[model samples]
Target: MNTNDATRATAETMPDLFALASSMEDDMHKVSDLAFLINDYLTRGDRITLEMQQALCWPASELVEVGRKLRAHSVALYAASKRPATLLNEETRP
Candidate 1:
């Protein structure tokens, strides 16, 4: 690309991060975007969708595993849409 584009990119970018705990919170989105790809493609069976991959907000690989917990959420949405609720208690929620 042109030097102008390079200069603009460099000027707009944040400083390099050495550790997650110490890194600026604002860069989470960029880091999480990459983590999503790693989880979605490198992982198999019941992978998180792109929409979810973007919603975690914290933007970290450890956080991306939240997809595993979303199984109940997906089931709940499906149950809510079905003809009617057949069960009660915890079953009704999930």
Candidate 2:
């Protein structure tokens, strides 16, 4: 219905921030491991096959896009956290 109602509904359905942060941290570690492995392969003096190149390219691009989204989310969350609760509630009210 109204903006306030919509915001309340969304908040009701949102996941716990602590759990989400933990999961994200775990995923980032996995990504870091993947980066280390890729770096090792690149520096090991072994020729990279076309298939390996193709596989890495897709994930690298996806990672870049994911990183952009993560950065945007982090910035928005930080900004929201800095604002007063009254201000946030007023902004959401219709």
Candidate 3:
């Protein structure tokens, strides 16, 4: 695939940030005991930010959360990609 096609494929596979965070249970990536069972998060760059993290750290959490979740949710995983588009004034306004 060319770069544009590759980019689209990547975008399509990333985790749905909203969905992963709302799931209370996790698949055990490794099992020993409850304490020892490591979910995907144990690998690092894994799991969604805590809800508290999102509330206090808007843009930073929003930015990094995408990649963290992409790692955790493996079946839906996608390599992270970035696009640089300048925002118009109205789009930038909060």
Candidate 4:
């Protein structure tokens, strides 16, 4: 596709991309909340298994990674959206 076509396509999809990222962020928050609940439960118990701690730690770590990636993607999207139209022109780039 031509540059204009590509730009139009990107513009059209930006909202959906942002929405999906936002949804993932919301899901990550839920995961964090669940982890907190699990920790609370474990603390109230007389004994906690290593495996149970690992179970909570793994998802929480994964959520942190996912959140990092989402933030990076959001930054990229914002940067792309802010680029001057001239920069997207084929003749303008080195």
Q: Compared with the true structure, what per-residue lDDT tens digits does model 1 show for residues 9-87?
A: 4443312112222333443454455664545533654444556455544444544444443444445444444322223
TM-score, each model? Answer: 0.28, 0.39, 0.23, 0.35
Better of 1 and 4 by TM-score: 4
Off by over 4 Å in 1: 1-43, 46-64, 85-94
**Distance from true position, residue 44, model 4, in Å?**
29
- For model 4, give the 10-residue run with minimal summed lDDT: 84-93
Per-residue CA lDDT of model 2 for 1-94, tens digit only, reads: 6899767655643433333355456436544645645554445434444554465564554555445554555665566555545565666668
Evaluate residue 24 in candidate 4 and report its C-alpha lDDT on the 0 to 100 scale.
64
Error of 3 at 44 (Å): 25
Error of 1 at 36 (Å): 6.1
Per-residue lDDT of 88 in model 2: 59
Give the Cα lDDT of each candidate. 0.43, 0.52, 0.39, 0.55
Model 2 ranges with Cα > 4 A deviation? 1-59
- Candidate 2: clashing residue pairs, number: 0
The per-residue C-alpha lDDT of model 4 at residue 85 equals 41
Alpha-carbon RMSD to native, per candidate:
19.7, 10.7, 14.4, 10.5
Error of 4 at 13 (Å): 0.5
